[model samples]
Target chain A: MELFTYENIIGIAAGICTSIAMLPQLIKVIKTKETADLSVTMIGVLIVGVSLWVYYGFLQNEVPIILSNSFSVVVNLTLLICWFLFRKKS
Target chain B: MELFTYENIIGIAAGICTSIAMLPQLIKVIKTKETADLSVTMIGVLIVGVSLWVYYGFLQNEVPIILSNSFSVVVNLTLLICWFLFRKKS
Candidate 1:
């Protein structure tokens, strides 16, 4: 069996991309105090989704999926809280 | 092995949740015509992330992942275009 096929590479890259995808939004939200345009439903659903992914990783015994999605859950949670705090501004 | 293990159930739920997570945001954006609070960097990164997911699915030959992320890519792309369109308002 080959180690690190193209599928593995792309899957890993995709996971990493999603894991860190929210940082920019969190930073922008904190810096700009803007949250009105961000959808609460989207954030809520994402939290649920990432949280499920984390559990699924455990069930699938996939460490990479677990770690990446755990990070995403944290970021998503933080973003959600920030949205609540900042949405009232402007 | 059972067909519907907890992992599969959770994984499928996660995929479904992530797939449709953006609809509410799109609806909100269209109804309110607000996009200033949205992050272009976040959107850009997400578009890339989901697109890569689609490719990863193809590489893995996972029909569910491909279908779900394809829907997400469409929604994310639409949201990006909407962000561009409505950002100037208010």
Candidate 2:
């Protein structure tokens, strides 16, 4: 059996935590169909941040990191879009 | 001048992106003082994921990773707490 190296454990934990963090927002957005309370500035800032992460992942050649964060970018962008559309309608 | 190696760049980018991703929700919770739209399950999942990342960092002995994710844990936990408080009040 392969030993679970400390590095692998940490990486996995980071991935899990970050990924789960998105859940509450995702659920809230989906169920409430309301993002009035959400801030546009915050979402914009987040987009910039995730974009940097993607760039960082590319530079590092870390496939797992890149892939996970890329997916995150997509999810965040979608939420932002949803917020915008909802706001415009209301 | 320190050379921006591919790994370093990627690490920086990931850090920026993941850190920024928290902005929208944080702002939303703070501004509106409402977490009605947020999901408890999602927050729970994220907490687990970040915890894993912290563990992974410890296992790997990567100070940067551990430090960054530890900060993330604090931010995320704060948001979760805010949500609970808001929900209870509402």
Highest-lDDT candidate = 1
Give the CAPRI class of candidate 1.
medium
What is the Å distance of residue B70 in model 2 from its true position?
Answer: 0.6
Q: What share of the true interface contacts does each candidate keep?
A: 0.84, 0.86
Best-fitting candidate, measured by TM-score? Answer: 1
lDDT string for model 2 (A41-75, tens) is 77777777676766665554444455667777887
**Model 2 chain B, poorest ten-residue lDDT window?**
B1-10
Candidate 1 lDDT (Cα, 0 to 1): 0.76
DockQ of each model vs. true complex: 0.61, 0.54
Task: List lDDT for all candidates, in order.
Answer: 0.76, 0.67
lDDT tens digits, residue span B25-83, model 1 = 77887888888757788788888888897887676555545677788888888888888
Q: What fraction of the genuine interface contacts, i.e. the true contacts, does candidate 1 reproduce?
A: 0.84
Per-model chain A TM: 0.79, 0.80
